[model samples]
Target: MAPAAITLAAEAPKLSSANTGFMLICSALVLLMTPGLAFFYGGMVRVKSTLNMLMMSFVSIGIVTILWVLYGFSLAFGSSNGFIGFNSDWLGMSNVGLTELWDGYTIPIFVFMVFQMMFAVITPALISGAIADRVKFSAWALFVALWLTIVYVPVAHWVWGADGWAFKLGVIDFAGGTAVHINAGAGALGVILVIGKRVGFKKDPMRPHSLPLVMLGAGLLWFGWFGFNAGSWLGNDDGVGALMFVNTQVATAAAMLAWLAYEKIRHGAFTTLGAASGAVAGLVAITPSGGAVSPLGAIAVGAIAGVACAAAVGLKFKFGYDDSLDVVGVHMVGGIIGSLLIGFFATGKGQSTATGVFYGDHSFTQLWKQFAGVGAVLGYSLVASAVLAFLLDKTLGMRVTEDEEVSGIDQAEHAETAYDFSGAGGGVVSSVSAALAGTSKKVDA
Candidate 1:
């Protein structure tokens, strides 16, 4: 090779330990979200279904990790015709080099691969909340595998892949509002539509068994979301990641307050559930727009999503499709609100040159593009997910027996209960008898 060519090759971006370390930490943080989600969903269900709810989220971590290593990464990030991607070398992550950097970034290909894997892990886990108590565990696992392959991989390619149609069309999803939130939310809606409602739709008094667990889960999700939103930039070379970090906090706080206010006005009380749900709504809304909008814009996104999602939760009752945990209300609606608001809040200054309607060179062009991205993902996920659920419901039986569901899916499905009431019963009786004996002795004295 000529000297000039050799020089140019040698000058290629070298490995950045700083960026690699940042991403590794970020990857760990993202992985924690699956467990966080487990706690969040687990706490929201009846005591009879708590273990099942937690397992649904936990299972996705195992299933998606294997798939992502095998061919999921290749199909998602490989070069293709803007729909799906495949590179044989990346099929098993076989040909990737440890020193090789992802194109346009300092992090290694493996780091990027694992980082994306966490995203894949949690997206399907998000759907489990909707079908909580009734679905068979085996059927749910199959759905996760198929949905990740059929629905998530392609939609991810569309929005985040280099040659993706949505990427090429200039859709601004800084994180995963369209690909993750909307996709999961729509998929939840579709599956529930097919599987029908939980046995006692209106008459049963199904309340959350544990609010403390719910609060703990929400706190974890909030803590991990900083990495989820900021680390998308791949490096801290610029201040964009920092900006995203700030926006994440601002938006979450704003959404929480907005939700509490709305609850106080509408329900006449400030409930803890509302606070947790509202914070999550803010997180979802700001996920896509944080990189493109200012802090104030993030506040707008969070507040709007908080109220909209808070109100949207009621739609399940009105429409009569049983979304046990309000996935449709919070994630789907919040994702749409966040993605579309980017067209109005984007300043063309933070992460991209594209401007929103309320920003420089105000135009509706970005808004239309946002619509296209949202509509395509939502429509495709809705249809494809329903079809997959229908096939599974017909073949393997998606739901447990009605008796199993009414009694407790944990025992029927996993052969164990979340709480051992037999021991508790004995303890309670012993205490009552001891107290009665003490009272009788005191009276004799």
Candidate 2:
């Protein structure tokens, strides 16, 4: 037999049960991060708006799940134009057989579908934090539905789908630096600009109501992020997944320290909120570069993102847009750092063969590609989100009444309260009033 014939005969692709099981578990883990996000955001809002925050995240799971199966997946990953994927054959996954495996992928087609579905669900939910406390729940839902279709689906296709414009152009987003983080961040900015600021933007004590809840949510996110980063490889056979997992940990740890150090130098206090925010910033920073960069590179990315995001969070104060929970600062800013720095830090040794400028490859080509990917997603998401928010605002009305917002969105929107501390006693009521008065006095002071 000729050598070529022997080589072709020696290579056979078979489905591995182990890879299937690993991916299924990874899908489940990624799904958990959405609820964890609910807690993280819920605790940041006032006690009254807590359930609404949680509801915002929870509702994405329900809405996006149905949409993803019906056609969202097709629009995102179907075989079609490079800029966008929309094949009727993939509508409702009709063309996908249960026994079918995605080409060149080790897992079943359905498993991969669900995994990407989880990502689609959470991307829009990340925008909710920017407009917390004052948004009408129904309007927010409508925005999510529209934004996902117009902005997220196209961007997801561009970055991830086979033959995607950016994918073909050599952009390297191992996870979701552009598609998820920058997309959501810019979308949040657009919606917030349309919705305007919370009633008390600069003057109120909008401090987190419960640090414990925030920490719990952060812990869940940290645990689940292993899957979020490593699972992108789609297979554990290569040591790339292992490297991603380690990079995720060390980057997050470094970020937390960097944020605390910054806070101590600037604000003179190391708040629990800083630790949690730093951890999330780190996670966002490493998502794109973790598999491509070394542990030291991860640390550098995380540390830069931590400090940059910490400072960026204050931009709302300077620019006078109320990003209620700093989603723009952490997700968007950290994402840009991670995505762009990969242009300098990526080693040609990893799964990605592209070498960075700093790796002595001495070319800015990869850097320009990164910028193009980020710019395309950011610009598209921003304009699409603004249009959606404006349409929703014009029709359904996006914000609650001023009275409803001041009193609390939970009762006005959900007809429920997060805490029933009202029924405690007469003494408790007086004490609580006095405490609030004292807080107001301090704000004035």
Candidate 3:
């Protein structure tokens, strides 16, 4: 009997090289998004603070990676209570075997761990755009560490962990509409409220210094989001990953067009910034719903989010919170729209077994469940992040001095500039001299 039991265990599903390879590629794609995000946010700030804006996003890569390896994975995914998780063996990834499968999946636990680490990396980075240009780099770093531990970890557990209350309740989050988008958006709102507004909020032009750079960043984000959305399925054994991929592209296109239309109607012109922002809004809206809805449903989700986020971005000016980059408008609003729309568009055909309000049985049960998940994450992240920012503000000081802010955060904090104008005059002089010298040679010849 003992021998037979050992043989049965040995006969369990083996590691799939295809899925493993696919996931590795997906992880790399997701990792690229942070730097892409850096460019996106960096270009939106004034020239003086470009590097600081980029640094805020880039630093999250370092901060979250170390924490994830140390204890974040365990706290997020370990089997424990529904609220939070902890496993002694997974603390340092000490006992996770190289070939050991991730429970019922064919991929190794290590592969899944690294893939998830990418998600953890980007979530905090999303919040950086909200508080850009005025934050102390050290304070922001500290906040990332603390927020990941206290807010993100538990929320991740509650949504994705096996025994999590939300997971048990059948709330469908294919990727991270709640855990990543809403959580980061709400956290951004909380911190910005505490840190106060930038130096010249409504008075300053404060326009994006480089629209081209913003477009580049948005392009990269759009490309990498394929991995972020599809990889959440964990493998290609099923067709759900393919479905997510198609839906992502469709929704993004629809949203971009929708946003441009709205911009033309509201602002009288379709701006490049509007196109980029609209695409992002679409991405955020589809992150959670892509797996559950058809391509048509994705279009609806994307179109709605695009117009909604386009309108929401203006609210900061009206209410005066000063979210530097519209993280709340795009991410929070988009995420909530996507997550809640899941209750309407889910066909019980794609990833989950649950049908939405407009589908089979026309039940509102899933809608209520989604409300629970969104409310829980939003409420907790907002309150807890505000508290964390307040504590950091009191002790280490979250904002730089007004003088440093006016002088520029890149020079004050990082001692570097995104562009070096000091050498521009010299280069111009050198170029004119070379051109004259070439003309002289030509005449002599």
Q: Tens digits of per-residue lDDT for model 1 on 1-445?
A: 0000112455677789999999999999999999999999999999999999999999999999999999998998888769998878889898999888887677798998999999999999999999999999999999999999999999998998888899889898988999999999999999999999998988899899999999999999999999899999998998999999999999999999999999999999999999999999999999999999999999999999989999999999998999999999999999999999999999988988888988854559999999999999999999999999999999999999999999999999999888774453657666777788899999999
Tens digits of per-residue lDDT, candidate 3, 135-174, equal 9999999999999999999999988898888888888888
The lDDT of each candidate is 0.92, 0.88, 0.91
Two-way lDDT contest, 2 vs 3, winner: 3
lDDT of 2 by residue, 230-303 (tens): 88888789798888999999999999999999999999999999999999999999998888899888989989
Residue 201 shift from truth in candidate 2, angstroms: 0.8
Alpha carbon RMSD to native, model 3 = 4.7
Pick out the ten consecutive residues of candidate 1 with the lowest summed lDDT.
Answer: 1-10
- Point out where model 1 deviates above 4 Å: 1-11, 424-445
* Comparison by TM-score, 1 against 2, better one: 1
TM-score of 3: 0.94
**What TM-score quantifies how close candidate 1 is to the native fold?**
0.94
- TM for every model, in the order presented, reads 0.94, 0.93, 0.94
Question: Which one is best on lDDT?
Answer: 1
**Model 2 TM-score (2 dp):** 0.93
